[model samples]
Target: MTAMEQGGTGMAGARRLRQPAARPTWLPPGSIAFCLRSWAAVMLALGAAFWLQIDSPASAGVTVMILSQPLRGQILSKALYRMAGTLAGAVVAIGLVAAFGQDRIMFLGGVALWLGLCVVLGTLARDFRAYGALLAGYTVAIIGIGCIDRPEDVFTVAIFRVSAIMIGIVSIAIVNDVTGSPTAWHRLAAGLRRGAAEVGQIAHDAVNGRATPDDGAWLDLAARIMALTSQVSFARTELADSALRMTGARSAMVAMLDMISCSRAIGGVLPAGAVRPAILAAVRRRFGDGTPFADEDAARQALNDLLHAAPADAPPTPAEAYLIERTMALLSYGRWVRDGIRTLEEGRAAPRVARDVRIARQQDPVLALLNGAPVMTGFAAAALICVLGGLPGTTTTLLQVATILTLSITTFDTRAFGIGALVGVPLSTVCAMVLDTRILPYGSGLPFLALMLAPVIFAGCLLLIHPRLMPVGLNFGVFFFIVLGLDNVHNYDPTQFVDRNLHYMLSAVILFFALTLAPPSARRRRFRIASAVATTLRRQFIGRGDIASPALISRQYDRLLQARTWTGHLPRKPATLRVFDRIVSLGDLNGALARARRHLARAAAIPAVAGQVARTQAMLRALHGPDAAGRLLDQAAHLLAAAGHLPPADRETLLGAVSGLFGAARLLDRNARALRHYGILPPPEAAP
Candidate 1:
């Protein structure tokens, strides 16, 4: 009945006391795309776009642009660079072919060398920053390999390729704009609301001293919310339109993220004892009393009124100063997002806001450098193919390679490296056979082909409904179709087509290997594991009240969360959050480990072991707040070393003691034994 009371309730009582989950209309949006879905959508879109031409259509690149828009600004950014690189490479090819006649083998050799450099560039690219550089290099390959004997026709193809690329960019941008585009404000608003709800739930659980499986789920939910918060800030800064739509969207989204962040921070500080009764009452209503705060008529009415319009009453309670501070921050981001949308609708440029928005910018200079590295390599590769491989057509070959490589850089997914290789080879031959050999000479084929290709109209209208893939997938499919005309393998020796495809495939694969292995994977997996500790702690701390406050559990999780951002080179995607979740689960395992040690130590009546568990809990509390961790972890280490000399069955005891302590060190600070690789943890000053 009161905060201090306890009941000898079994699991049956717990379940009976628990309220059913709220919301009768809560239809799940389902999950994000699986690897298979991503693969299929990409292949499907390309098949549809390039059914007419054996030489790939730029439409594939463009479609990737539209489909990738949900990832913030990256999708279009990739397309833009690829288009530029393809055009530049095409023009350069025209010049090279014109200066040297098709009869000269040396001229073709130069082209092959140039394309090799492009592959290296693609290899170095971390993200879209390297896309253009890769494009510049591959441009040589497309030109060299595809143009072959009809060197004079390089100019005509170059012009057409550029035109096709423009069509693709426009198509993606327009389709994105028309399809009730996901405004920054909408996303930000949703994230803020979600974050706020999490804070509320966490505070209620914290005060009432309750922990449930849902709490663990909630922690995962919170980490994801942080990701959305990051997105809101990015929108406020990175949006291109600069119109009312963009401004309004950014404003609203920013407001929501900032507000909820502040609100949660304050709510986290509330003492567990203060709000316990009110929470139990709410839970009781949801179960026995048939009324819950969030779901009941009274609380829902109060919430609706509060949100329906800002209250005209005096300022909030002192308990809510933090909440109001959070509210103001939320309002700022919300307003910016709202203003952006309105600005877009009005067809106006940005109208200055009362205050400036702060942007966290770390546009890596290294990414640009890495992107540039491939140019020299690509040129060398291009030169080789031109001379030794006898690619009479250098420019078109180089153009295709450059464009595809550039387009592929949009995704951070490791697997996509292979897609670039598989897509480019056969498509290169197909384009060479159909457009290079068959269509232009007849002159009659061009008009008919153009008419037949007009089905781009349907693709344009239903771009969103088509298969979804990373930008690279669509690029590969389109290029595969584009270069390989519709069923023309028989015209050339089927083996020759296959052989050439394999050759180019090897070339692309070689390029991919070159680019990626250059820097190696930086090996950030450990850091991800560390950051997961923090996320897990937050979830356990906020949601699980029944579980005793095991400090090492908290410490281990905090360490995981803290390790998340230590990778000095920040990536554009939210994919890193997945790594954090995995590591945090490991933190949960550590808790079980500590509990087992506690049972064993209590049985043995080892004061040293008892001291170690206490110290471990102390370390966990300090994990959340730096100052509190002092001397606790050291004691854990000392106790474990003492336990190490015990008997064989005592192996579990000694191992648990040492392993748990080591895990604690990993969680506590970057300089700690386990986290030394991160190299950014501050000296253990207490958290303010």
Candidate 2:
């Protein structure tokens, strides 16, 4: 061989040595673990059901699939609620059979009304609580409609259904506990820590005037905080001292929201120049990285330094005073965030100040009623069709309709639920066909049956783990078991399979039309949220707002968060964006007024300022029109001048009250156009 050839061979050898080893595809360990646990629970449930000789052994398997969750806490909590819902529904089912068993029309009508009421309640709830409400609705359908032909057997069927659900719940709980699955509290704690850091960063940026996050960013942060509320509830089922831990978690969430409000207010009043204030530099150094103070003394000392950083010789301008008030509030809330996190970690009570602060939730009765209408109407129509057609599987079709409608009530996108059912039913039917004919026929025992079912369950589990594919996976997993129709005596009939699945598909198509015909309007939701905010502001303008600062601010935050959620779903039109921005500004104005009232109540104790406080309250009640903002500024100035003769502490309190009023006036001027548009103020006059 020539030298060139030898050199080429050496280079190839080097390349071969540098190449990495080939490996099989990677799967998430958590997903695999969850799948194995779920599969084991399903097998156990099936074995128990078979031994008991239940009427519908397949229902047990369906229950296990429905209750499957990654976290042990979620599974157990949901199982509890599911059992409660099942029992409540069973009781109602028995009553309906006794009262209207002789009249089919009355029985069906009663079922529809019960389902409608459940849907409305479910729409108003959150998390597993909502699931419980929805489950109660459909359980009535399952029991009452399943026994329409044999009303005498209603009680028997109800007993068997509840038994199957109990078996499934116990199986999953045992499996999860033996496997030592992850706890929700651990995950929630980590999330709370991460959220505190993120919100701290936002506060730091606001103080330094470094960044101004858009509406989307702020809204995203708010959503994360709102989501934690559900997690806190779930975590309560996992620990002994859950009440204390949950109290701390609630405080942390409330503080984070208050911190965001302060950050936004500070951003608006921050000096335009690039030069940062000395106190701001102190704030950035202390909390820029989001680390909480170690103790109360440390937090107090740090805050004291921040307050003294402002010049004592000269009084602050209106904007400067506002900035100082917001900064102080930011630091105090940040300390509360730290304390709350510590309480969660150590499983102790939160500080007394934060223990009483509750996060308020937004409720819309009109929206709930609107959501119930579609479900009720769809059920009525489906019942008419099934009764009129008088087909072989008409009863089964009505059951499917009730299930789909009740389940879809909890989901934001009903169309997706329909689409998932449409695609999943056929796929599940085909898989059941192949499995029944080729696989299950060759198996004779429970072990062999579980072995054959493993791959199908695993595939469904993989899809279920993905967020985007969850709806499809849910439908596939649930319908596969139902369509398979597993029992003590396996009758593999191809015709029965095809006929049953056709009815299921028909129900999905009906759901699609029912949901799409008059879907909940995004524009209408936006208008309602805006109207709510305007009503709140109008009440505040007339001195009818809540007196407690925490309650007032918490309620305002809830409304603003709801607005942010709906606005994201609307088309990104300029007008819509403007309306959302105006809503946020209004929230800030609301907060400023709340804080002003709190401080005014304090300043009222001083005899020197009592007369001025009375006049200011009267003026606030009569506030309106485009010129109302100017009058507010004038009144705030007068109050400040009157307090100049007081001592330092009293004068400082008076200044806080005046500063809040000034900030409110400025915000009112900025949002005057929106105020008129929402009918909170008189509309502009036409030109002469």
Candidate 3:
């Protein structure tokens, strides 16, 4: 059966149709279980804090809420980083207080500089590690600024904050473990299997020449796998067999990338008449047959037999030979995918896949430094307002404002997140008053409080799962509990509650105005991000690095994905899509160049082939410089065309590589000119 037919009806088809499980009223799915467990842990931490007579129990509560993510492993990992950041920030706060305690101007200036540096570092680090940098940055603001009036109490406040955070972390880890929260290993396995299936399908499509290899699906898959690495680290700490599982899952990710590269290569080389029905049948069976091939050896032998035995109506040519070579590479990568799955499923270590090629993400240091400006300016402005207003109890609220703005603005659109806070604070304030005055006043036990909280907590957890509603849910949920201020000694003062709510609302407003002033518009942000990707692509072509070919290609694809997501919200303009397509095309050509270089490493009978290969590399480097990129490309094409005319019998091996180079260079030249139209490539200086 063909791949389409194989994907059809009944019990077999049910596996492909993934529907969300029907959630019952009483029971929670795995993710919600995580949320529920986190709430319980926070409550327990609060109890411990109160029992021990900690000065600020609310700090512990906030720590637990911030560390709470859907995945247990992520929570565990983040908790560790949070503690490290807290300790580091405490040290810095103590030192800063000692150096500039008496000089208010110097102290505030030092704090601003520190916050700006952290934001810059966070922007440079793109993954989970960025969280650690951000936490460290804002922690100093939280602790140092809070202790400005009483420098002597800096040590005492730092001790209390660290101790409380530790209690919360330990509590959450214990509760999550005891409650059997879903493990990260299972998530990793699911992602690997899904990726393998996708690679298989893409391979099948490529063999039939029905593939658009540069589409977004492959980029999404790569991004998902990259995002899972932190979770995998957490899983290794929890499950003993997780180390082997991580290896296998990682191999599967790399193999999927390899399959994509090979698919494009084969698609380019395979002639219209070269691929027969038998070849397509074999590919379909290999991918969708619903049965394992027993081993890589068996799968290879079967593919070999199909290729050798299939009828070819046309005479042999260079394209047909190249097709066979790339087909072999495709089958080899497909087998790796199978072995990786087997290894993950059976808890056996798979053979090591060579990933010596490092993927380098190019970040513009200047832009990163500039991105820190808005964040720092907003923070500085908030501090200035609070110091000048000179209102009692405003210091605490101002610290909260600075903390929220610094963290949120770094990761998201400043205005949008501030707006979410603006909407969420009032809703939470009303809920807090009703629960504290109306519901909890008559009750006197922990059980009554838990019962009252269940509904609100459940609702928040439900909203957190929705993509669009998450910001609102998080802002409301976290601030709601803080506003309630549940304590051992209940103080039912309506006036105090009203006053506190007003301060919070005012603080959020101050932050909103601070962020909105001279904000980067959506159009500008999209343009900058797209330009960054283009700049990175250029660097990849010109700069010599040890990055792996597959990884390099995958990183470029991921950047383009980010750019595409941004452009989706902008006005529909063909120039954006056209520029994106050119980047995609250029990336493919670069990959082809890398592969051609590797082919030249093997001995060839014709010496002239090596010279053509070197010439192509030089042309690619010149294209990177954007100086006469089109002219250099034409020169490379001439060299390849001359090499193509060499005697076919003696230069059989070199001729295929030569033809590949000529095609890729011509495509690169066309894309470079398109990029010039958008001013991505350096424009020619106006004629003097």
Candidate 4:
């Protein structure tokens, strides 16, 4: 099934475009209880209809379906949200009718007021939570303000629509539950493992600079991963995976994004060798389960010696040691989380390794504004269409808008919900005209058509559950019912309805395009890349330290691996992905350079190696930065590259050559700095 989801706003955000893999062995004819949830839903829907004075079974069905979205938790939340929105909208609708039934001008004010409030709510909400607020605003437009002239029928129509949604929700819930369909929670956890593993695997490819399948693979997979993540994140409180994993994945994602941005500015830089071999090895070895740590005592003993290592009288001395220590801490945490899982607290408990990243508004307001343009444009179009509908009364306006928004959200496969709705509404009108006008056999056939459609309804229900394609089918189902409910059904013209819906679609598309075309407010791509560089720097400087102790080294490599995995996940604009690729390479370069620095630092400690190593380190620092470091790296690369290959130099000498940037970057941090300190900043080849 095509997994539709929220927009891909973050750098390398979720992958909505990928086709879901073949179903695992655990699927097919469901259990008996699957029917129970739907049964309950039907009861609840009927009760709601009775209490709210809703007039039709169709209205009840809509209500049931709206609330019966598989996940009991989400189902309940939606139910509450729907109820609150309906009640609130009904009150406002009643007020508008009381005030504006007398004045057309006042009705517009009411419509504007309700929508503005929904917009406000949408702005603050995250994930599915925003839907309710959006619905609240629209419901008022659909039920109250749209039918301003027909004040008396407001409650009846409103009640009816709510009832219909309830009925649909109930029917589906009972059917689903009785069939023993998998719960969202199980899917959520399963998705995390699959997503995380895939993240690790694909990221390893990018990190190692493997060019095949590439970002397209990740991109195809990311949307669904994210959508699943969101679903799992919000599934029952029992669910425990951080929507964002705690460790390097966060930083990796950030760096990848930054790298992408930086490359855009610089152009065509691929980090073909940026990935650490250890990362690829690790990704391949573990898949998504994470590295086996055995137990805490084992982990502690492994880290004990590494943690005690003191700074040496050499380049990268302090930095490498620090890198070693930080990595150990993270590894221990991962082991801790793993142990918790072994105990079966699964979703109910969290592992100590749960290094969930802080979802900060990493970008400023300007960036946020840029990203929001698409959604805002969608809203604007919705408003204009309402004004243009020119329906006779508020009731007609309310019903159509409800149908429109619901249908609008259905075209997720095409990545344009607004456009989808526009297309769907007309299709619905045609279906309505065809079935209600052309085919129905007077009064006797009405019930018979509904009964015959039971099978079609079942099939549509199956399709509606799909993550991606469901919206299209769901829209069709509701529209099918909506048309049957229209009183002037027999006289309806399918062509005219289609024409109106097409324009409705235009409004949605205009909004979508407007938003998509707007400049991104945040440079998430830049952060992802920068973070990647940082991870590499940390690991490379600590090079060889891990070798002295496999466990400690494995832990450190794990952190680097984690970061690399997520960096690839940051949102990817076309411009950003290229930048990200370069950053990945740069990240590898940074790691390699750090290892060089560590060698220099250690090599300098040798009795006969001191002077040469110091010189190498000094030269390297000079070449790598504006000061000494920049010059040093430049000299080494120039010297080495010119020599036709790496020269067989002393380990200390190579280390010194690479630590130059480390020194300069350190100095820059200690003092306001730039890379232009020419006097002291000389490359190995150029240094006096």
Error of 1 at 621 (Å): 27
Model 3, range 1-688, lDDT digits (tens) per residue?
Answer: 0001011112221233233556544334565676678679777887787788776776667677777767777777788778877888788888899899898778877877777787788778755557777777777877888788888898898898899889888888888778877777777778778777766666666665554344455555556655655556666655667666666666666666767665655555453454455554555455453333555566556544544444545422333434544555566666667777677677875554433423445465665677678777776777787778877666556666756665664545666667667777677788889987898888866567667877776666665566556666667777776777665565788888887667777777876676566655556655665666555444535534223354565565555556666666567789767655555565555555555444443314357565655665554454443545455435434543454345433233343354344444444555665656654444334211
- Candidate order, TM-score descending: 2, 3, 4, 1
Clash count, predicted structure 3: 2
Candidate 2: misplaced stretches above 4 Å?
A: 1-29, 271-313, 350-353, 547-555, 606-608, 638-656, 682-688
RMSD of 3: 6.3
Candidate 1: regions farther than 4 A off: 1-160, 168-245, 255-354, 367-408, 423-472, 485-503, 506-519, 522-688
lDDT of 4 by residue, 94-118 (tens): 7777777777556765565556556
Clashes of each: 117, 0, 2, 125
How well does candidate 3 score on lDDT at residue 487? 54
C-alpha-based local distance difference test score of model 2:
0.77
Off by over 4 Å in 3: 1-28, 211-226, 241-244, 264-318, 355-364, 486-490, 516-550, 601-663, 675-688
Best by lDDT: 2
Candidate 4: where are CA atoms >4 Å away?
1-53, 67-74, 95-101, 152-179, 195-228, 237-291, 294-297, 306-330, 340-415, 438-450, 462-471, 486-576, 579-688
